[model samples]
Target: MTFSIVARDGDAFGVAVASRFLAVGSVVPNARIGVGAVATQAFARVSLRHELLDALAGGESVETALEQALAADPLREQRQVGLVGCHGARSSTGADCMDWAGGLAGESGDVAYAIQGNILTGPEVVRAMEEAWLTSAGQPLPRRLLGALLAGDAAGGDRRGRQSAALYAVCPGAGYDECGVLADLRVDDHPQAARELARLVELSELYFGGPEDVESLRGDLAEEVQELLDHVGVQGDSVAEALTAWAGEVNLETRLTPAGIDRRVLEELRRTAGR
Candidate 1:
């Protein structure tokens, strides 16, 4: 009834999941900035998600962390889990999990990633997920993880149908506030959860993205923004102040750069100002 991908991209780690269950994000996926990521589904032992990350944070390898976590759970046989740590990746499908249940992963390597599912339409689900993950090498970490989840969904994920999905990840100093939170988005309940998850990922990138395209507020750029603000009916004494006020109105203040604006913001202003 669930499929997920857990992966480590450089110093970042994340989980992307979709399931027939309601609010799967609140339970199935877990990750921390400095540790690793874990997805526990099947019977879905939520505690194991934390346990696995805790063990990894305590310096255990992905293999040992998974082994110990499941060993401590009485219903481990009913559980399915995928984990990725600093050194390796591990996946487990319990002997008693429903048919078409299993995982794909490499226990030790530079690429720490795992794909797993249970009650899936067929092995094709995980196969498609693994293929997407392996082939999406140059993309951003969060998008790469979501790519795999979307592939699983496209290949007939969770034979039971979809209700919820999530994309959670962390990296050291990548967040808007420089706090390492890359993304934490979820479709708690949606008919097309995986696709919805993808949409949320795109929105996250727009709102929480960095200042790569921001230009210094001077010369032609400043003049362009002043004209745009006037065209958009945004009023202020200074162009930057007016733009910041407009950004606040549109809930885009997080996208503000140092005395400048993101190019995407300029694009939006242009769209509205008809420039």
Candidate 2:
């Protein structure tokens, strides 16, 4: 009843899932850096989420964690599993008795993914998903993930149907400070939920910032920011004050913390660059 991809991008990693079932995220996805990402679906087992995540975190590779988990389950044939780990290791399994269940694994640089599902059209779903992942060059990871999900859907996903969808990820920068989810959201039953969720993620990245996005804006800082602000129309004290308020409310100060000036400085810059 679900199709999902567990992937790692550079220093960031995430799991995206779409299903014709309710609360798929609760059972179908498990992920961590030191460990791996695991998705257990079909009949679905809640315990496997934490158990697999914990086992992966303990330093087990994707294959080992999945083997141990499936080994303990007597009803393994009625299930589907996928996993990916820190060293870019990946593995997937689909029982012959699992009614159309199948999966695929890919390894490329710091990026890797395990795509799988039950009630899916064999490798077609995985192929489409992988194609989207490979073709989405120069795009953000979140966009690539959504593109993969949409490709799977187009190729025939969850033979039973479509309903809820979700996205998840982890970043070390989030530990520093951020007022947002780690890209976790659920579209319980919207027909266009996956697309909608992708749009939300893009919007969030615009107003706030993402972990993978920090580095490009960090170097030779002050001049570049002034140029960007000047280009965006932040002239005059009154307008700059508004910009300052906007930045503060969104906690963007972390990017400009090196400026070391009073809020008035931003306000003046805004006034100078008035639209």
- Per-model TM-score, in order, reads 0.92, 0.76
Q: Which stretches of candidate 1 lie over 4 Å from their true place?
A: 107-110, 215-221
Report the lDDT tens digits of candidate 2 across residue range 2-115.
Answer: 898888777666788898887666667666644556677777776887887887788776778878888889887777776677765554554554557777888888788888
Candidate 1 has a TM-score of: 0.92
Worst 10 residues of 1 by lDDT: 105-114
Clash count (model 2, backbone only): 16
**Candidate 2, run of 10 with poorest lDDT:** 210-219
What CA root-mean-square deviation does each model show from the true structure? 2.0, 6.1
